[model samples]
Target: MSIATSPLPPTEAKEAAPFRPKAVTDFASAGLNPALIESLVLKYLLGVGVASGRKVAHELGLPFGPFPEFLRGLKAQQIVTYTDAAAANDYHFSLTDAGRARARGYLEECAYVGTAPVPFADYVASVEAQSIATENPKEADLRRAFSDLLISEDMFRMLGPAINSGKGLFLYGYPGNGKTSIAERITRCFGTTVWIPRTILVEGQILKLFDPANHEPIENVRSSLLREDDQDDRWVEIKRPTIVAGGELTMEALEIYYDRDNKICEAPLQMKSNCGTFLIDDFGRQRMAPIELLNRWIVPLEKRYDFLRLPNGKQIRVPFDQLILFSTNLEPKDLVDEAFLRRIPYKINASDPTEAMFRRMIEIFAPKLGFREIDQASVDHLIEHHYRRINRPFRCCQPRDLLLQVKNYCIYNDLPLEMKPEYFDFAAENYFTVL
Candidate 1:
């Protein structure tokens, strides 16, 4: 198969020295049971053949306190031995025949051997600690989040309460009018980050939670709510996630996913999006029927909690902890009945820009395209001749699209980047060719 399924390169055999934060000074602090940690340690040794106690802790992404004591016990039991005796607990450790046999048994059952999975209970609890309900974003927060964007006071007023409520809203309007862009920026209001485990354990199965595409890592994070010393490295600190699932969003993707052969499970989309924003971009047009998608959330939307079943048929409750946005170019009334609409109470329209707003967008974007002196007369000329004559509605994206055409026209003619009525004429003729 593909390169992603190929064998991963072996991690370092010897554990490197890593500083421990005060948050996780012991196994209890890491929120893991002793037996679970031991299984991961043995499985890793089975794969690597040798690793130091420090390395084992580091690789497991656990605190060092419990490892030293656990290693001493394994050493006493003749399951493992320190290859070298050093004062710094730097003995390169290797497993004995007995330890390898035990590791083989562990592998036969689950086969998870990388970073240890955080207990599922701990995961649920952490979500509650950082739930979007706990966040109260102010107008200043929204403004700061969307400082560079062209959002009006009316739209901001509508968004402020909806965001503060941390509930679902419909951002319906024409395409390319910044519904997706607005959805993307909703996370910035909370402006705080939370810690999530890389892998969550559910009944001996590994459920990977951290996704690089959705979760951005921060160093020297300056959020007051989640301190580095408040949680172990087992949990990675990320800005509240803004997960956008477009037309490809399926009902299966919204549930617990398991690969029996691989012995791995994937956390449902909502679990990964906890304490963040989950925008169903192009919501009504998803592969699954709009009714089916809305039905799945009926209970979760009201109770603010969801239930997912494990492979073993065990139903587990997880926090439905994100502000859900349904962005669509289609009319909301045409997509869902009144009952569904009521559940999604706030339906805001991101309609076409007014003439003044359109001009402002052109003025703001023109300088970035190397035209510092944007000809006001040329802009007026384009609006009067092109838009008014044709009775065309101005879209927020038109300025960028038409300007690029002007830039290209200048480039092909060996001319400088300047806004002129003649250039707008060329841009409009070429840009509106389809119409």
Candidate 2:
């Protein structure tokens, strides 16, 4: 069950496509079928390029001998190209363009089934409106921050309609433009429940129902059977699930791996992120290419479900009911073309804050970070000294960082936390760009 084989050829010519079998029974009743198995294998090959046949076999709970035959079948269809290292008795498999298309098609088909609506009766109704008794100070603080920015109500209104339409979002701007902060605020405002796969060993066998094509977790199925009286307190809480992964996500980290003793392969990030928000923060900056990432998600984003295969040749469909938000500082035109951009419906541009908002931010953050006396005179002086004189765009971090530096200076010098010209000079020198 090791996938440490050598590289396979990119493609083979004059090969016929492999036959894709259909399931005889419902996915739940039949457990796994040939089509599901082929789809899962295809996903792994596409995601990881060439993996070890033995490793693939173990993960799928299939006999190791059948894997080479599967690889041969895939190779014959020209979906994958295989290289046999007779010396090592290892066969490496890589997906061709046709293979990739087949895999994507399989995943797209799976996504539809995964996104099937759950029974409404299973959900309990919580208080819709906020009450004085239940009001949280943290929420008030967030509201205050939003109010201070004076963001147009029209801009805010677009969020609901866009999400309701089940379209992806693109948020872009320069650094310090509050894009990340706005994403956090959206999550806080909507409330979010993080959905992680519920894995358990039943009869010494691992069963996962989090497949995007058929997103039926054991918990979801159990919840459906509950009586109304038994489900009074079990309302579906609307909480946004936020997953930030990119710089840390490697090719190996995105696929299934074989475990010999347990005889199982675990689901990857995309599968775990079902029914939640998957935020690709600092998009176009991951180790993988932006096109590669987009290609991986194209099917799921379009269809709202994904099919993932187990190492043992079992394909599982999972629901993809999550808000996907791509936050980047790079220009959209530079990163992706017009054709690709059309797939993402909501494009929110977050620019630098206005001077009034900037000044207010300075006043609010400065005092809290121990700048005890930040009068309007000192604030204006700092702004004029750094931004106007040096011709640098005002950064929100500057105010917050400058306040921290001033506090550290006060503690070191045994002085009160007062905003002086000296502290401003230090802050301006270190944080602001001088012309």
Candidate 3:
């Protein structure tokens, strides 16, 4: 397949350039879907076999016949070349220089927009500054780190005041109301390198300490700064201290472990989460009792600091700088008693959106995913028929999900990219439950 043409060079320098279409547009121009191009890039990077036309079809979930056409398009763009003549008739593909560049450029763009890669040591220091500043003017550092993209007007007001008050934040709402999305987005506000402790084998023993930046083993790390002549030049130092833990976190994961060889204890999750936001998503659904989790966190949550004792009877007071966000769909009263709830300084309810909001959200997501137009009336009809008729709460993610289903259906049936009422019927049947 031929590769797609590149977009024009960037016109102006930007602090953060908007996403410029290069490979994606190139493939689209050659009659391949942009999403298919992305899948190809991912499959190639993952080293999955892309040798047979049938295998490519199976892997990409596309029709078998179209695989040759897709490969031809890629070849035309010089993105891939077949090594053996026999492979030319098959899907055996390899990246050309231009193809590799396109893949790397696309990833760089994603990382630029999504993650802020900061040196591990600097990230730790910033988290400390943000946490300490929470009581005063310095709190801006921490406050800015927790900003969201599309927060409601009420939430913006509540969040700022609540954070300054040094109170915990509580976010609750119906499922698919963007509660978890909003919480996850907060991490983007900070520079990279969330501090998380990891288990490392030092001297043939497992000891958990603040993992060094860049996830390198302790033994491999250079102990001191070296001059050019003294340097081995074999290893490059990089710092990555950002830590995000969910799902598998236990009380033991939040404590110090004794490292007999190093004579130091491993730092727990709370310690690693310092200076970063610690989001407790699906708040009431953990295996641990809600009261137990709340009680364990009460002292540190209130004081913004915690103590950990070493095996040899030494203790260290670590700064608790993590901005804790509790996200749940369960009712506030059901999740915690009034007394415990009060300890959480800020409460933002991520309620279901109004009809107007839902419509706007659809309009926003439609064009991005190749939905040329959304039938507002059709969407409203479904909302009224499927959701309102059944007394289900309006969900923000519904539009995104519906668009995905429509896109998938179009691909499955080889239909033109258009939003039809049938798409909603399909979505409703597959996704929604009758109330």
Give the number of the best model, judged by TM-score. Answer: 1
Q: List all candidate RMSDs to the true structure.
A: 10.8, 18.6, 20.0
Q: Which ten residues in a row have the lowest lDDT in candidate 1?
A: 13-22
For model 3, the run of ten residues with the poorest summed lDDT = 111-120
Candidate 2, 1-435: lDDT as tens digits:
877966554353213232111212222322344565677688666667777776555444333544576678888989888654532476767788999999878655432111111121111011112111122224344455366444545556655455444456888878776677666555444332322222322222343424433232223332332121222111222233445665666655555544654345455665444444567778888888878777777777787766665665765555555567888989877777666687787888776666876877777786567565667777777778877886778665566777777778778989888887777777667665542
lDDT of 1 by residue, 152-204 (tens): 88999999999888878999999779999999999999857778888988776
The per-model lDDT (C-alpha) reads 0.83, 0.56, 0.57
Estimated TM-score for each candidate: 0.88, 0.57, 0.57
The numbered model that scores best in lDDT is 1
By summed lDDT, the worst window of 10 consecutive residues in model 2 runs over: 123-132
Report the Cα lDDT for candidate 3.
0.57
Per residue, candidate 3 scores C-alpha lDDT tens digits across 395-416 of 8888888788888889999999
| Candidate with better TM-score, 1 vs 2 | 1
